[model samples]
Target chain A: MGVKRFIAVLPQCQALGMRVESADHEHVLFSLPFAECHIGNSRKQLIHGGVIATLLDTACGSVAVCALPRFEMCPTLDLRIDHLRPAVAGKALYCRASIVQVTPRIVFTEGVVYQEKGRPVSRAVANFMRLGAGKTPVEMDEALFSPNNEGEE
Target chain B: MTYSDSMAQLVSETQRSGHWETLLEQIPYAGFIGLTAQTLGDEILFCMEPLESNTGNPLLPALHGGVIAGFMETAATLNLMVSLNVDQVPKVIDFTIDYLRSGKMKPTYATCILSRQGQRIANVQVNAWQKDRETPIATARVNFLMHDK
Candidate 1:
């Protein structure tokens, strides 16, 4: 399955309005547009730290899965994030994640979230356990790669 | 009243009335995620009911890892706000989370314990559990920079 389809299968990605800007075996970049619902501090109009964390986690997970030869269920083992600065309000947020290392059982990834090119909002490092084939839900496979489901959403 | 004073008053009133909904109304993201909090004596318990939008994997139908992290962080921040009685929102500096188990599609609960509270920074450890309090699905350590007003 393609990376975009894989991301589309996840419900949280849909809920957050995450879109695939670019993806490949080497790295994946995702974007989330700013919305009023994402505001953590209404008075300051700042996006929530958790929203940034969500973006990092999603990016890291997607990149890890894409690194595999085939799509598999990759469950996060641990994740760490550092917020360098507040994300710019009323702008789209972007996260670029890449695989640091890959083993038979685990995939390590690192990611950074930013609105502008030079200014980073947060950085993340995470690892996911590579649950081999057959671990993923059969229904999910059908929903992801199925010819009938294509162009539906 | 200044912003700090108003925040303090809001917190005290919420505590006295045991109405956490009033406090949550101010946080848009918390409301968006369907996060709820209830005062448990001096402590607070945060909860997120299973919502379809929060699910990651279908079939086993687990909650998204990011959602779990978001819930825990949100809980910690609110817990800090109530504990410190501060006016400004605490800005997260860093967060580390360990996933012990998959967050099943069910009601998840979390509580925060202050690890340390210095003048400028505060460290909070959050534990999230479903089914039982002892077996946590995820545990997180969050450090925040306090901007006291």
Candidate 2:
């Protein structure tokens, strides 16, 4: 999507400092660099858990549309995350994803988030339901996936 | 991706990087990597290594969900170094994650990629794994707001 077009689609995502690291029809990759503001402590950094949840949701939703035409919308049905560790602030992070399985009714995907030097950080699997053409999928926003509380679908 | 020293050096430059370190000290999780700040060509990297005592989640054997989310957020912020072109922390607008499997009883690493960068918004994806990349424990997608420094 063009810069203007992307902005129109996700206006609230602006605070993430995201940059399209790379993309293809079947795959897309994104990045977020760390700095002082993201840190929680000298011994550790404070990164909101919901941020990770959103990354997985978007990756899965996009992967669900891999077989569909561009500009199509796919909404998430189920998203589960297993956080492994506390992220260290002031570092670069890399997130990559692809469509693992897709069906007429649903799309199954697996995605990963990593640190520079190719260290594995977290892995996620999700399912997305394909929406009818010209139909808007369910509105699943960040507030719905905050780690502070056990999210409800 | 290279560390400035073999062992992380606690210095003022580290604190000046951001308040992440400051906040991390308040939490009592053992899986925190405790990384300071990093720099790249238009990008910066975040680092964290799990502590040995972080076994609070008996079910997962490693870090807890709350802690993992925290790490994912940190990785997303690293992408800000590219979008904002500054060393400031990016505010998370919203995000989602899918936990593929429970992490190993060891450390989990994470990194983020910026899929869309704009004048007012950003989109990022994060992947995390332990020991081997072949098997990932969790993945996430995040959106953040870019405002004045």
Candidate chain B TM-scores, in order:
0.93, 0.65
**Per-prediction backbone clash count:** 0, 104
DockQ in order:
0.80, 0.08
- Docking model 2 quality class: incorrect
For model 1, state the Cα shift of residue A119 in Å.
Answer: 0.3
lDDT of 2 by residue, A71-126 (tens): 44454555655545545666666667778776777777877877755666667777
The count of residue-pair clashes in candidate 1 stands at 0
Ten-residue region with minimum lDDT total, candidate 1 chain A: A136-145
Give a tens-digit lDDT track for model 2, residues B62-103. 443434555676667644543444444455665576666655
Error of 1 at B127 (Å): 0.4
For B7-83, candidate 1 gives per-residue lDDT tens digits of 77887777677788777877888887789999888889999989898888766778989989999999998899887
Deviating ranges (above 4 Å) for candidate 2: A1-4, A35-43, A137-153, B1-149
Give the 10-residue window scoring lowest on summed lDDT in candidate 1 chain B. Answer: B2-11
- What lDDT does each candidate get? 0.87, 0.53
